[model samples]
Target: MVRLFILLAAVQLVLFVLALISCLSAARVRNAPRLVWVLVILLIPLLGPLAYFLWGRPLPAPEEGTVPRRRRAPSAPDDDPDFLRSVDTEQSRREREALAQWEKELENGEPDKPQGSA
Candidate 1:
């Protein structure tokens, strides 16, 4: 039917325009050169755009002046400054607790037991 033909033509036109715009606006193309993509889109309508969408468009590259993210290196507790400080504080607290326990024992006239005995 004439209406069917018109609809098909309109679809083709829309596809061609979308492909052209995408090809032009893309920062980088993959699998083929830009010129080749342009020619393909112009000469072969549907398949060209399909191919482009599937494989020709490259993943977006990091913008200029932006550093690519990197994973931090795993560090030991001793190697990390923050971890070392936390460990130091914990050790001091334990020492204070032990000292307080010993002072209490002395006040009660209880002799200190050997550490290994407990």
Candidate 2:
């Protein structure tokens, strides 16, 4: 019976320390504030630590659940509106002309050969 009591006490002490460290280190917590959580862990024995574990722990940051920015956003120049907007109009017109010429070459079924070199 003495051994059992000693084991329980040890468990309670471990719980109290874990709860206190978690409460202090967390960037934010839910329900009660940090001081209240600290007090609860220190004063309420086993139940205090259990309550802090259940209610005072912070929710996962919202960004953690979603795809990262690189995966979620467009990676290609032609597909991204912002990239197109930042391009100079003259440069954009030149690109369009180059694309049109390439398409015309494809339609003609001619083997692509370097011009001005042949």
Candidate 3:
């Protein structure tokens, strides 16, 4: 009975210290302010620190070298194969459109006079 009480008290003390350290070192606390967490840990004892451990602390950030893989954005269009292919298709389409427009203009009898000439 007394031993169990002592063990419980020691556990609570360890949890309190851990919660305080986590709150102080955290970049951002979730759900509540740091002051509130500090107050709760100091004032309410066991339950307060337990609550902080459960929900207030942020998850550990990924390490510098062990971060999850992601597809990087191409720095230039030339670096992207899809963009290179699309550029070819787009240039051809523009050329075809311009030829069709010129043919239509010829059929309509619009003289292709040089611009800026009287």
Candidate 4:
């Protein structure tokens, strides 16, 4: 019974150390919320470290080429009627062009470039 108690205490101490280390390491990374990290360390103990292992690492920033700019929200509807009308006109023109091209392709059939065609 005494041996079992000592083993349990040692295991708990190791778990606590692992959790603390993971939490502190995560805190060093920029942009991590400190308060949320502290709560994670205290509330979940063993699982907290594992959770952080899986989710705590920072996500890579969008790469240089082809990454869309992050937008907070869409621009509000334009107040000027003419400006809005111009935007709508531009969009409709593009849509009509796309439809015309698709209709032409449908009439002509697809290009015969698919692989494995004898």
Candidate 5:
């Protein structure tokens, strides 16, 4: 009976050590508070491990060969007003330059000059 008790105690001790180590390791990987993890492992020894197993593992990244589905890029109208304004200003500048060149050519009557009549 004493031998059986000793064996059971040894098994419990090993499990507790494993749980503590795993909790510490997982907490380190997860960037969680070490003191909180230590307390959890010590206080709710069995449930702590179960909780970590269910929630601690990082979600898998998308596979290397898989093509991500096409999605529209998010526009930050309010958050990035300056960026939108810059784009708008650039487009306006191009339009103005094009119009100016066209008006200058028209004023010079270049298009009205007979084409292919050298």
Candidate 6:
């Protein structure tokens, strides 16, 4: 008889703690305010927690009139035509000039050392 009483007390404590935690942490609980739900849980013990779990949980509502967006990987800079076209015109001219200088040096017997590298 004593063992049975201790088991029931443990069950009641578990129910009360679980109910309080669930009530406090829920995104939005049911009709009653959070303060009221908390009071209900504390005052009523086992029944308070059970009632909150059954009726106070938020139900996910589908958003109306919205089209689902398709998830796609972002395009790389090389894959984007707009990004490729956006390269600086001055930079392109500089690259062309450098290439011409390198080719001219290769043809000449005496060549100048490259400027950027020591």
Q: Which model scores highest in lDDT?
A: 3
Write the residue-wise lDDT of candidate 6 on 2-118 in tens digits. 999999999999988888888888888887998889998899878888887787756656579875556554478877665666675667988999999888888895478767976
User: For candidate 6, what is the TM-score?
Assistant: 0.48
- Say which prediction, candidate 3 or candidate 5, comes out ahead on lDDT: 3
lDDT of 3 by residue, 29-90 (tens): 99999999999888997999999989898977778889665789799889999999999999
Model 2 weakest lDDT span, ten residues long? 64-73
lDDT of 5 at 112: 46
lDDT for each candidate structure: 0.86, 0.88, 0.91, 0.69, 0.68, 0.81
Would you give me the overall lDDT of model 3? 0.91
Global CA lDDT computed for model 2:
0.88
Q: TM-score for model 2?
A: 0.52
Model 4 scores worst on lDDT over the 10 consecutive residues at 25-34
Kindly list the per-residue Cα lDDT of model 1 for residues 1-118, writing each as its tens digit: 9999999889888888888899999987988899999899888878888788788877777899998777665476667877888889999999999999999999999898888885
Candidate 5, which segments miss by more than 4 Å at Cα?
A: 27-34, 45-118
Model 4, position 97, has a per-residue lDDT of: 100
TM-score to native of every candidate shown: 0.48, 0.52, 0.52, 0.33, 0.34, 0.48
lDDT of 4: 0.69
lDDT of 2 at 73: 69
Candidate 1, superposed: residue stretches over 4 Å from native: 60-118
- Which candidate ranks first by TM-score, i.e. highest? 2
